[model samples]
Target: MPRRGKVVLVQVAIVLSLLLVWESGVRAGLIDPFFFPAPSTLVARIGEWMSTADFWTDVGVTLLETILSFVAGIAIGTTLGIWLGLNPFAAEVVQPFIKMFNAIPRILLGPIFVIWFGLGLTSKVALGVTLVLFVAFFNTFQGVREVNPVVLANARLLRASKWSLLRHVYLPSATTWILSSLRVSVGMAVMGAVVAEYLGSSAGLGHLIAQAEGVLDAAGVFAGIIVLSAFVVALDAVVDRAEKRLLVWRPAPAHEV
Candidate 1:
């Protein structure tokens, strides 16, 4: 077998063995299943959840917030990144203001969003936008700034119009960075939605977890967390696939499939 294939197989074996040990430990009471349920129990919860609409509703709500926030973040961030990056004066002028907002903890804005947007999905969407936009913005800005100066000079010398420069130079240069940012920001988007829900909400997995905590139902909390993790992984995978398609100019890494 090839070295990479062997290494991957070994890694999978190790993970499977660890899961077995964890399951055994829980069953033997060496670990408290109440606090940390076995993987099987969580899987069972997933099965039970699939049988009902309650879980689906919460999942849908969270997904809605995540999608809206992600779209808005990328749109706003890309526009700002491209604008600021192309104009040195603007970039320098706004650096401090951007950094100041970035430094603030996004979750703290949740209650305020709730106050302004209410306990509906809007609050969660706003919080998610706040979390995702900064990440996307920084990545895009860095990407644009890092574009080879020689390339920009060449494009300009060739009489490229403003629209042509953006399409041929700026957008292409920033594509990789923007995609990379999206990959990481997807998890943050989910976190923002959950945080907003936690602050005030009538629905969403975060709301369910909050309710479980009030009742001290560890299993339910764990179940909700597991559900959220699944959603993040699924969404991240989608982004990865889309990135590969959009950034076809990039060669696949030797380590990636």
Candidate 2:
């Protein structure tokens, strides 16, 4: 088997071993089930959720919010990042404003968004966009600015048009940074959407978790968290696939024979 496949298998084995230990420890009363629910209990709760139509609805709502916010944030960030990266004057002019917004706690804006957009998908998506935007923006900006000066000079010497230079030079260079940052950006998008739901929302995993916490059901909370983690892992897998496809021109790392 490939080294990557072996690594994945080992990781799965480790998780399974830990889960077994957790379940055994809880059942044997070595650990408090109240504070740390057994893996079996959490799994059962997850199963119960899977059987409910409402659970699917909540999943859909959260997924929609995450996707919308992630897409919008990436679009806006890439555009502005590229523009500012190429124009030193514009970057300098907007630096302080960017820093100011970035420094503010995104969670604090959740209530404000709820007030502005109400307890709906729009508010959640808006909050997520805010969370994801700067991460993508900064990565793209840095990537573009860091492009090789010699390569650029050579491109210009070759009489490359502005559009051609951007397509063949600038975008390719920034793609690496943008793609790497998108993994974090996607997680932030999910966090933002879920947090907005926690504040005020009719549906979503965050709302479910909030409800669980309100009732002091540790199993329910753990189940909800596990479900949310699954979503994030799945989304991250998608991002990984996208990165591989889009960055096919990039050289693969050397592997031992």
Candidate 3:
């Protein structure tokens, strides 16, 4: 088998082994099935969800929120980060306000968002954007600031226009930092969406998990968690592929760690 196939098989084996051990422990009364549902029970619950149209609707709602928030956060964050990077004086003036906002607990903003945007998709997306924005912004800011001073001086000597300098010098240098934040921001976006739904929402996987928790259904909660994990993995995989494609010009390391 190819390396990728071997890696997949190893992953499957590890999961299956753990499941077997967990199932045995539960059956032998060493573990409580009620508190910690068996893998089989969770799988069965997930299968039931897969068979229902409502489950798909919930998944779609969460997926849309995640995507929308991620895109919005990246767009806004990158623009501001680039601007701040270019103008040190403006960045210094805005520093305290940025710090104050970042220090605020994002979870606390969910209720406020619900009040402002209503208990609709808008609130959920807003919550997610808040979570993703800081990560992208900080990374991009650092990337731009870390650009080589000598190279920038050379560019100035060459009489490069602002647009040319930004396009060729700033953006290329910051691409690494921006892409580094993409994977992390995507996960934050999902968490923000789920948190918003859990607090107050009529739909989405978070709502489904909240419902299960309300009824104390361990299997249902576990199923919801598994579904969410799968969703994140799928999204992260797409980001990974995009990062590779975009950074193809970057040279590979001499050795893998």
Candidate 4:
């Protein structure tokens, strides 16, 4: 097999072995399943959810909120980040306000959102957007400010106008920071959606988990978590692809830890 294929097979084997051991340990009564669910049980519960309409609706609501919130965050954050990054004076003036908002716990803001937007989808989406916006904004802002002066000078030597400098120099320089923020924002978006649901909502995975918790259905809680994790992984993969496409000009060798 090719190297990548061989590595994938090894990973599959490792995962399967771990699952078997965990399930065996639980079934043999050597391990408790209450706090930690076996992979088999989680899988079975997920399968049951797949067979239900309510499950799909919950998933849809969560996905809708996550997508809308993430898109809004990106639009607002990117624009603000670029603006602040290009203008040091603006950055300095706005620094305290930004810091104050960032310092406040997002969970505290969730309640106000609930009161303002009620138990509707708007509240959940707003919370998610708030959570993701700051992350992207800060990163984009730094990316802009950190553009190399030598590059700007070279662009100036070529008689590049402000528009040309922004397009060619600032944007490319900040692409790294924006992409880094995107990776993190993907998870934050999901978290915001779920937390909003937990506070008060009639549907969605968070509400589902809350209901299951009330009934002491440990397996169901694990099932909801597994679903959310899968959603996060999938969205992160999408962001990774977009980053690769948008920043194709940047050589990969420079990004090593």
Candidate 5:
């Protein structure tokens, strides 16, 4: 079997094993169903939720918020990162302020965002943007800063225009770093949206989970969590595919024959 297939098989096996163990424990009265629903029950609950239109609407809202956050964060972060990276003086001046903002726990900003933007998609997207922005900025800044001095000098010797240099030299150099940051930012974006929804929203998976928790419906909560997990996994997979396509120039690691 191919390595990827084998890896996937193992992952599936591991999950099944865990589910089997959990189900067995529940049946044996070794685990409390109220707190920890059986895997089967969780699956059934998820199916039931999926059959409803409300669930899909919640998913769509969450997905929209996440996508908006990811794109806005990347656009703003990349621009600022490139600017500050090229202008060392400006970077130095703003470094303290950036650090201070980054130090602020983003979760605390959720309620503030809700109040500022209202308890809707805007607030969720704002919170997610905050969560994702720093990650992209740091990675992109380092990427641009780490560009090869020799390559830059050669480009300068060729009388490359600023735009030409940015397009050909800087962006290409930073692509890898930016993409790496994107993978990490995916989870951050999702967390931001969900947390914001949980804090003050009428819809989204987070609201669903929050509702379930309020009613002490363990199965519903677990089912919501499972759905969210799958959602993240799907987004991560899309990122993975995009990364592969964009980084086709990247060399593959060597393998022993």
Candidate 6:
């Protein structure tokens, strides 16, 4: 078999083995069903949830919030990163304030956002943007600062305009850094949305889990978790595809071969 196929097969085997063990333990009364639902029960619960329209709506809400946060964070972060990177004095002036904001635990801000924006989409998106923005900003700032001085000098000597330099020089140099941050930002975005929902929201996966937890329904909670895990995996796969397409010029590592 191809390496990828073999790897996937092994992974499947491992997961199945673990699930089998868990199910067996539950059946033998070695595990408490109330605390840890059987894998089968979780699967069934997920299927039942999927059959409902409300579940789909919750998914859509979470997805919209995640996408909004990811895009807005990247756009704003990259713009500021590039600006600060090019302007040393400005960066110095804002450095302390940026650090102060970044140092604040983002999770604690969820309630504040909910209070400001209410328990709605805006609060969730705001929370997610905070989680994602700093990651993009720091990576991009570093990338821009790390641009080769020689190349920059050469471009300037060639009479390149500022726009031309930014387009041809800074952005290309920072693309890898910016893209690398995206994978991390995806999870951050999801966490922000879910946490905000869990804290105070009427919909989304987080709300589902929160509702389940309130009722002490282990199966429902686990099922919600499984769904969220799958969602994150799907988003990560999309990011992987985008990364491969954008970095086609980059050489593949030996393992991928």
Tens digits of per-residue lDDT for model 5 on 1-257?
Answer: 99888989999999899999999999999999999999989989988888999999999999999999999999889999999999999999999999999999999999999889998899999999999999989988999999999999999999999999999999989889999877799999999999999998999999999999999999998899889999999999999999989999988869832
Q: How far off is residue 126 in model 5, in Å?
A: 0.7
Model 1 residue runs over 4 Å out of place are 3-5, 252-257
How high a TM-score does candidate 3 get? 0.94
Overlapping backbone residue pairs in candidate 2 total 0
Least accurate stretch of 10 residues (summed lDDT) in model 3?
A: 248-257
Residue-level lDDT for 171 in candidate 1: 90
- Alpha carbon RMSD to native, model 2: 1.9
Q: How accurate locally, in lDDT, is each candidate? A: 0.89, 0.94, 0.94, 0.89, 0.94, 0.95
Per-candidate TM vs. native? Answer: 0.92, 0.94, 0.94, 0.91, 0.96, 0.97
User: How far does residue 214 in candidate 5 sit from its true spot (Å)?
Assistant: 0.5
Q: Would you list the clashing residue pairs of candidate 1?
A: none
- lDDT for model 1 comes to 0.89
Error of 3 at 219 (Å): 0.7
Comparing 1 with 5 on lDDT, the higher-scoring candidate is 5
Clash-forming residue pairs, model 5: none
10 residues in a row with least lDDT, candidate 4: 248-257
**What residue runs in model 3 are displaced by over 4 Å at the alpha carbon?**
1-11
Misplaced by over 4 Å in model 6 are: none
Q: After superposition, how far is residue 13 of candidate 3 from its true place, in Å?
A: 3.7
Model 4: lDDT of residue 193: 94
Q: Which should have the higher TM-score, number 1 or number 5? A: 5
Better of 3 and 5 by TM-score: 5
